[model samples]
Target: MGAFTQMIMGYVYPGKPLANATFEAYAMMCVDCGLTAISSFKLGLYMKIPPKAMFLSQVIGSFIASACEFATVWLLFSSVENICRPELLPRGSQWTCPYNQVIYNNMMTWGAVGPKRVFYPNGVYSNLFIFFLLGALLPIPVWFLARTLPEKKWIRLINVSTIFIAGASMPPVSAVNYLSWFAVAFFLKFVVYRKYKRWWAKYSYLLSVAIDTGVSLMAFLVTVTLQIHNVNGIDWWGLDVSDHCPLATCPTARGVHAEGCPAF
Candidate 1:
């Protein structure tokens, strides 16, 4: 998934660092403002609302959303790591096996243990999170840009461009996945604008929360299942592993040589 996301960001954004930066910015925006604000802003302009109100609402809402999102991610990192670590380990592999231990060691060595990796070594994941946090704060400028260009054509163009850029940089799979949300946003913009009076009234905040919660739960379940499968020596998503013996094969299987299959 991460690799897919990287591919999509690369294609959509184009410039090496800049493309990634843009994607991080956009994701942070979504995390902070809930898709509602973004959809509402686009809808409002499409419906010819006063630019001032639209800008104010988007800015204020985005700020609040970003704060909440930051807090939520922090809490999840703290709590989920504690609950998920044991489950990430191999069934019988000890802490000393380099290949089997790397996951747990990385988890702890990355600051899930004591000194936070965000402050120390400042590794890739930490840097990525920091970039995301910083990007969340960029909605202010986005709001300003939206206000400066209230004409529906420009607004739509900009939105589409960014989405395309982000999508292109992402892996084909990730781009396809993220495009689902873009499709939803596009539909909402059209429907909400057409029926302005029923927009917020028909879609309760609870509905949004429910959707987000369901997605998160699904992700968690999938992660746990994959971890368990990997640890149990099952094919991890059917990747090629002919070089290594299946766990079912003991160290002294039929004609297998001792050196070639040490862990047989």
Candidate 2:
């Protein structure tokens, strides 16, 4: 949502960081709020809840949630020292705003630098244009195969839309996150469903909701109680580890030397 809107809005208001940030915020909120409404509506339908009641609930909930979110952001920015400045922050500081750093980069990349330079037809990143072609062409083959080989059940599994949307999380999302989801989904959807069909059918959706809610509550409680009080968690080798390869940012050239990276 932020990326798509920033791409167009950036061109519209080039070099205006304030405008870029403003539009990015609203664009993301619109997407998330809209999706939440849709998902809640579907869940209501599944649970045989009245549509009017569901709509009313969501309307009230959205306002409350938005207010709380605004207050939280205001408090954080108001109280936290060097809130979003990673370089200025102390080592191992919990206030190093990684997500905000991404937003700041987008503001610079699309708003200040402009897509005209970054995605220029004959520029250094010209290869990035291939994705546009791939997005358009990939579905055609799937459609053709599905049509021609209608009897082949496997052809239907090639969902191009799902494949495209799968990368929606990839910019900051790690592969381990996807693997964890895949592992759990395989066990529940395949193994559990096959072995205990009745139990899976009864608790699957509820279990998903419970797990999501539990994690969210736990994080919120920890943030409010421990983090806000400057009480740090115990750090061990495992807890202090960075979840990335050391050579990931190293230059690949024959005579290149990157600080803190082994010479190649």
**Residue range 1-264, candidate 1, lDDT tens digits:** 232344355444433444454454566556645666667878888789998999897788769978999996676556443323444544432212233243333233322332232232433344444544555565556667788777744553444335435744332133345668878666666666467747656674546668899999976675556533344344353232222435433444344565445532
The C-alpha lDDT values of all candidates are 0.51, 0.79
The best candidate by TM-score is 2
Distance from true location, Cα of 48 in model 1, Å: 3.5
Evaluated against the true structure, the overall lDDT of model 1 is: 0.51
Of candidate 1, the 10-residue stretch with the lowest lDDT total is 111-120
What is the C-alpha lDDT profile of model 2 across 125-162, one tens digit per residue? 65776887898899999989999999997898989988
Q: Which 10-residue span in candidate 2 carries the lowest summed lDDT?
A: 235-244
- In candidate 2, which residue ranges exceed 4 Å CA deviation? 87-94, 237-243, 246-264
Off by over 4 Å in 1: 1-41, 82-169, 172-264
* Per-model TM against the reference: 0.29, 0.82
